[model samples]
Target chain A: MFFYLIDVFGTMAFAISGVLTAINKKMDPFGVFVIAFVTAVGGGTLRDVLIGRSPVGWMRDLNYVYVIIAGFFLAVIFRKKLDKLRTSLFFFDTIGLGVFTLIGLEKGLEINLHPVICVALGTMTACFGGVTRDILCNEIPVIFRKEIYATICILGGCVFFLLKALHVPDGLLYILTSGVIIATRLMAVVFKWSLPPLSRD
Target chain B: MFFYLIDVFGTMAFAISGVLTAINKKMDPFGVFVIAFVTAVGGGTLRDVLIGRSPVGWMRDLNYVYVIIAGFFLAVIFRKKLDKLRTSLFFFDTIGLGVFTLIGLEKGLEINLHPVICVALGTMTACFGGVTRDILCNEIPVIFRKEIYATICILGGCVFFLLKALHVPDGLLYILTSGVIIATRLMAVVFKWSLPPLSRD
Candidate 1:
């Protein structure tokens, strides 16, 4: 039940991110909705597809679609106030990332996939929506270019498994894993941590 | 048997296009292979996922991977000669687009989706690999911005259903629909037909 709330919040945060990007790009309403929906669900969809899960997670549940629509309107109505809410938005986005990573990792474990592939799937789930959103908006994906985004998800996945090996209980595992992801992302931002770009030379 | 041959050829053509793009971007060999592989199978994989088909098309068959690898080496080894082969590549690419559109539409029909959604899926299958490649390379997707690429796929899908409703034979339907897509695309290129860009003003 707690995780469900986190999932809804994450979806809304990602949807808002997508809507802001579409608005900034001057996209039509249809394009805005499409981008917003994809941003909230694209990563999970990709993970489900890779793991051979059918109909994807979003298609099976209408709530995601509803949340995305709500998110779009919320962002549009509060566009003027968004700049001031940057910090709050970032916090929500980080929480979303953490929740999404746990969801993805758990899904992978359900299918008995390798730990490494599960970690990769978790990272993909937390990151690919933004990648899809940026692609649709015709910009370089911020995660791919500069950010400690996907890396945090990967690290959190590792932590989840490490704790599992140490016989952590289910509820505590979820909280600890999410806490690790959120804290790591926050520290990365505060420290201006980033991955090095591939050298062109 | 004939459709299988066409699918293989199309995969090769798309892979070549991906390799060329990666080379232009100065990506390393691994990156080039990654881009090429995604370009070859990304669209169909997406379609399969949306329809709840598990393991995707490429994962079930190893031939696609082998073909993509071959395409990568071919493009790399004959880099300088590629300019002279532009016309041939264009022909192959057009054929690939038609075959991929048919494949996607058929897959959708198998799952009993609406014809309109099937058409959209067909367009996604025909164009999205290129879109994914461009996004990974940090460029605007050519299909979304320019030319009549996806338009041709949609038109061909419409033609497919129209002919099917008129009781066209299966073999003849494939030929006629593919011919329509190929001819329309060729004509668009010859006449420089393109969608109007959104005005900045």
Candidate 2:
């Protein structure tokens, strides 16, 4: 139940982020909804497809669609007040990332995929929405260049496995893994930690 | 057997286009291969996933990877001559669009999806590789803004359903549908046809 709440909220946060970006790009209503939907579910869709899960998570569940719609309208209506809520939005976004990573990792494990692939999936679920949104908006994906975002998800995935191997209880396991991801990301931002560019130029 | 050949050749052409774009962007070798592979198979992957087909087309077959690799090296070796082969490449690309559209439409039909959705899938399969490529290259997709590229695919898709409804023979249907797509694209280019921008400014 708790995980479900996290999933819904995280989806909304991601959708809002996508909606805001689309609006800023001056996209039409159709484009805005497309971006929002993709941002909220694109990562999980990719992961599920790769892992051979049919119909994907979102297609099977209608709540994601509802949340994305809500998030889009919230962004559109609250556009003027968004700048002032940047810090709070960041907090929600961070929590969403952590929650999403855990969800992805769990899904990967259920499918009996390799740990490495699971980690990759986790990171992808937490980051690929923004990547798709940026792509649709014709910009460089911020996660690919600007921050330690995906790296945090990878770390959280590692923590998840480590706890599982130690026979941690499910509830604690979820909290610890998500907490680690959130903390790692917060610290990365506070310290301005980032990956080096592939090209110096 | 014929469709298989078209698929392989189309994959190569798309990969070559991706390689050339990556080289133009001055990306490293790894990035080049990534872009090429995505450009070659990303659309099909998207279509398969959306339709609940898992392990996607490329993952189920190793030939795609091999073809992409071959196409990448070929492009690298022939970089200096590529500009001169622009007309030929354009022909291959147009043929690829038609072939891919047919494949996607057939897949959708096999799944018993709506005709309109089938046409959409066909268009996506024909155009999304370039969209993915352009996004990875950090640019607006040329298809979304420039020529009547996707428009041609949609027209071809409409023709396909029209012919199907008329009970066209299988071989002739395939040939005519692909021919229509190719001809429309070529004519659009020759006549400099394009869609109006959503934003006039």
Candidate 2 chain B, which ten residues in sequence have the lowest lDDT sum? B192-201
Error of 2 at B135 (Å): 2.4
Weakest 10 consecutive residues of candidate 1 chain A by summed lDDT:
A25-34
Poorest lDDT segment (10 consecutive residues) of candidate 2 chain A: A25-34
After TM-score superposition, the amount by which residue A183's alpha carbon in candidate 2 deviates from its true location, in angstroms, is: 24
- C-alpha RMSD for every candidate: 6.6, 6.6
Q: Write the per-residue lDDT of candidate 1 for residues B22-116, one digit (tens) a residue.
A: 99999999999999999999999778768777678998999998999999999999988998998998899999999999988888788766676
Tens digit of per-residue lDDT, candidate 1, span A64-101: 87788899888877877887988998999999999999
- Which has the greatest lDDT? 1
TM-score for candidate 1, please give it. 0.62
How well is each residue in A80-189 modelled by candidate 2, as lDDT tens digits?
A: 78878777778889999999998889888898899998999998888898898887888888888899888889999999999999999999999999999999888888
- Give me the runs in candidate 1 sitting further than 4 Å from their true place: A1-37, A40-53, A57-131, A138-201
Candidate lDDT (C-alpha), each: 0.87, 0.85
Clashing pairs in 1: A55-B52
Fnat of model 1, as a fraction:
0.23
